[model samples]
Target chain A: MNLIPVKTRILQKNENLFLFFIEYAEKNINRVIQENSVLVISSKIVAVSQNRIMNILDIENKESVELFRKAVIDEADEILVDKNKFFLTVKNGVVIANAGIDKSNSKTGEIILWPENIQEFADIFSEKIKKKYALKNFGVVISDSRVTMRRRGTVGVALNWSGFWGVKDERGTKDLFGRKLEVSTVNIADNLVSAAEILMGQAAECIPFVIIQNLDSGLFTNIQQTHKSAEISQEEDLFQISSN
Target chain B: MNLIPVKTRILQKNENLFLFFIEYAEKNINRVIQENSVLVISSKIVAVSQNRIMNILDIENKESVELFRKAVIDEADEILVDKNKFFLTVKNGVVIANAGIDKSNSKTGEIILWPENIQEFADIFSEKIKKKYALKNFGVVISDSRVTMRRRGTVGVALNWSGFWGVKDERGTKDLFGRKLEVSTVNIADNLVSAAEILMGQAAECIPFVIIQNLDSGLFTNIQQTHKSAEISQEEDLFQISSN
Candidate 1:
């Protein structure tokens, strides 16, 4: 599989994402959109398209540290760690620092919020691409850059997905040695999102749109059933239990 | 950037890893081995080459679950969660399930251990490749599949890396609006490993090696300075503190 980058100029807040994708697809004449291709899009672009940006200067007065903490608590679903230096919080099923509100890469004194209606917009974007490209089996994954709990730096995470079956259940399947496989469900969406980051990049790469071509046929599905393994409940989360 | 798969036949226990890479590189004439290109390898192959397979029958009787738990505890540096159904543990600095001992891809009744001398062997591999390809700047990353704390499914993690600088420090860098950036160190090796999985695959694809070409000049370094962000102390860990 090859991760083809569709280069675009810097996207401003509330830009038309669907229009940008179409324009780039039209301009990249050398790269053809094939059937069974998965278009991995950075969620930052989606968030930007939805105008999910906030001006940090508008709030917090001059006490940036205290107000930022208060803002995080308000936005977060649950606060996991409340250290004097930083806090780890849970938001929209993912445990993130500061409720996923990012300040880097945004306008000065402003923060970028995650897209509000992720799945709805992903479905609409998927439909627009399918119609325009005339492809039967295609997948759209909205990816965001996230830092892992114990690991440093940022890797791509699938915030929402459409037009693909996200999980590959290998519970009953046999391994190479014919041993019954256990805990073998493959998280296809997030891995694809991580692959998209090869082109999207963390800094000012400005190439948020990534096209992943030549995926297996079984990977495609409608938006309703695409996010099955995106989030897991806290009770069933071993890592969460271990943390507490 | 592009991820190109290097195909090889199913490798048996204690197979020569260096030989396999050299032979595969020789056969794939279509793809050029460029300078500053990264060779992303799955850690499983490295462990296999190191004769790290352990037969379950040799260790314990018919009580498979009990024996596996014992093995995991023995292998782990610290056990984080010891639930009846599962065990999440930390080994060598990273928190992982079952101490990262994998069973699915190995022979029947056998489990594969992570490479004992990961960094040392990675350096050797990097040196061998640089000489063979006559490349001034190149990188080698040994990658493994890992599940996140809250998220479902497996994503690629960089087990060890060599022949390149692994972290991109952007702590004092300016964002788009010239605001000072924080937590801006990009885990370059891990992201590259995740991108390699776009072709290396999780199952019996037998494509253990992936070649990435056309990286920035600043990314490459000597093996002595390759791995910088592989481990973190528990006290300074925000995620660990949250768990406490």
Candidate 2:
């Protein structure tokens, strides 16, 4: 696998997503879009391109120091942890810090919310990229930076993916000794995003896009199956089971 | 960043770690060991090389369907969840399913435990690799597959790392609007492991080793800091705060 970070100008608010991609491709002259390649776009860029941004001053009330609180609540499906410093919210069935509302890299007093209908946007973006590149097989993953439950530091996770299978199930498959393997599904999309982050720095790098080439094409035969396969039920959640 | 899976013969029990790496390098003829490169080794391989294998038959008694129950108890630091179908345990300050004792890929009726003193092994491995390649700066990360709190499927996480800073701290750093960024540490090692998993398949594919080149050498100047920086305290944990 080869990962090449696509460095572009600091994307302006409401920048055309297609033009941004074109500019990135033109600047990084060596990176030719290949068949069966995966392109990773930061969720912040997606939100910025869609103009899904908010100003802190707009949401603030005269009496409260909780300036960003209202925005977090408005976007969250469930507010799991409301601490003095941060809020862990469930949005679109994913629990994330600050509801995945990025404050850094935003214009002064402004913040970037997650792109509305992320899955749909990813589907459309994938279609456009496929058409532009004229590739038979492609993968597009929208990525968000996040911290894990017990681990320190943030890594990238796949918020939405299109054009390929995102998860690989190895259940009912035999191990080396022929014993049945259980609970062996792999999150292929999230893993790809993690790799892409090595090049995409947290701040000031302006490399919001990444191109990943040489992925196996066989796993992406049914893109719809990838979306469904990556999701887990509440009962199967290991942390939830332990919390109970 | 270019990732190439170093395919080698299925590692045998009690295999010499150094010999195993040599085999991997020889097999992947094109992937030269570059300076400032990172090598990712799966935790399973480390455990197997360390001879940390246990037969389930050895732990079970004549009575009680203690299938893997005894092994889980023996390996866990704290058994958080022990239900009919699964067990979530905290071992070595990390919460993981089944105490990170892998059953799949082991011999029939046998399982592989995490390598004893993973950090120490990684340090030694890094030193050896650096000497062999004659590189002043190198990175070695030992990784394990894990599922997140609410997310489906497994992604790679860093168990231990050496030769480079694994965490990038952005605390107190200014954002684009000059606002101080807090709670923004980045997991550099975990992201690398996640990318390495692209080539390292869950089963059948014997590509357990990966080489990542073209990383910034400045991050590796102080290797001692890398080990200490990645460890998070219980009080600072987001999940712990909510659980309390």
Candidate 3:
């Protein structure tokens, strides 16, 4: 697998994401965007396309920090960390800092919020792009980066995906010695999101779009056109903190 | 980055891992292993090198479940979940299932333990391979795979890295608008490990080693040869469950 980062000019709020992609990748990606390729765009860009951005002060008539508190409470399904420093909260069934309301790479005092309806948009974008390129097989992943517990620096999580299956159920699959494999599924897009996250720097690199070429063609769904991510309950999540 | 999975015959217990790599790659990789490239090897292989494999029945001469329970208690820094389904435990200050004790992809009735001394082994292995190729700069990553919370499929984690810095501290860096970036650092090796993980499957593919070629040369350390991964305490962790 090869992670190819595409540099683009800063995306404006409410810009048509498909048109914007063509404007930047039109002549460049035709030759490189082949079947079995995955197009990874940062969740920040998806939020920008949905106009889910606002000045921190505009969240409410209060200081930036206080306004951020209100916003996190509103966006979060459950607020993990209440206040003081940044807020640690649960949004859309995932744990992320400050509800994925990013302040970096934006105008000072402005914060970009995560897109509300993710899977629906991912499906639409994948359809439009595949139709434009006339490709039969392709995948799209909207990715977000977060700080993992007890791990330094940050790691990536796929917020949502479209055009392919997210996980491969290998529950009854046999191991080398014909014993049933313990781990059930293979997360096809999660690994790809991490690879692309390296190139999609959070600061001034302006590389929010990445093209992952040459992933195993087998991982791509048989043109199923699904726009969903796997849902795991807290009971199934081994890493969940019981405090929630 | 191109993750080229190298298929080798199943590594035997107590086998010298460096020798095994050269035996499989000596004639093939010299031309392709250039400066500023990283080689990712499975932690399972690292354990096999350290002779960490044992029959589940061997521990205290008990049943496999009782043996594994004893092993988890022995290996874990803290036991998160005692028993019932599988042990969710903390090892070396990170949350993992069964103390990173893997039973899949191994011989029938056998279990593989994570190498006891990881950073030391990563440094030595990287140095030996670099010397064999006579290259100035090369990195090695001892990798493990685990399921992320609420995320389907397992993601790769870098147990330890050698010949390069693991995380880039960008705390003081400025974003696009010259505002200080919110996130302090970027986890460099974490992303590369994920790229390599997809090719290094846990089943009969027998691809435990992957050569990650064309990672940005700038990410490689300037020959400091440090082998420590950054540490994060629970208080500093945003996602930490208070229950821990």
Q: Across residues B1-244, which tens digit of lDDT does each residue of candidate 2 receive?
A: 7887888877887779788788768767664688878999999888888889887663234422375777788888887767744777777656678889887888766778888888888888888988887889888888888877677778888888888888888788776556677567888888998889878877767777898888877667544634456668767776753321
Judged by lDDT, which candidate is best? 2
Ranking by DockQ: 3, 2, 1
DockQ of all candidates, in order?
Answer: 0.57, 0.63, 0.67
Question: Higher-lDDT candidate among 1 and 3?
Answer: 3
Taken over the whole model, the C-alpha lDDT of each candidate is 0.74, 0.78, 0.76
Assess candidate 1 and give its TM-score to the true structure.
0.91
RMSD of each: 2.7, 2.6, 2.7
Lowest summed lDDT window (length 10), candidate 1 chain B: B235-244
Give the Å error, residue B105, model 3.
Answer: 1.5
Error of 1 at A213 (Å): 2.3
User: Which pairs clash (backbone N, Cα, C closer than 3 Å) in model 3?
Assistant: none
lDDT of 3 by residue, A1-244 (tens): 7777787888887788888877777655557777878889899988988888888753334588787777777888777766455777777766778888887876767788888788788787888878888987788888988777677787777777887767766778787777788665767677778888878877888887888888777777745433234657667777656444
Evaluate model 2 with DockQ and give the value.
0.63
- What C-alpha lDDT, on a 0 to 100 scale, does residue B167 get in candidate 2? 86
- The residue-by-residue lDDT of candidate 3 on B1-244, one tens digit each, is 6777787887877887888887777555556677878999888888987888878853324487787777777888777665454777767656678889987777777888888778778788888878877877789988887666666677788877888778877877888778776566877777788888778777777777888887777777645433345677667777656444
Query: Which residue window of length 10 is worst by lDDT in model 2 chain A?
Result: A57-66
Q: Give the per-residue lDDT of model 1 (tens digit) for A30-124.
A: 65587888888876778888887766673336666666666777788887777743667777666677777776787766777777777787788
Worst lDDT run of 10 residues, candidate 1 chain A, spans A58-67
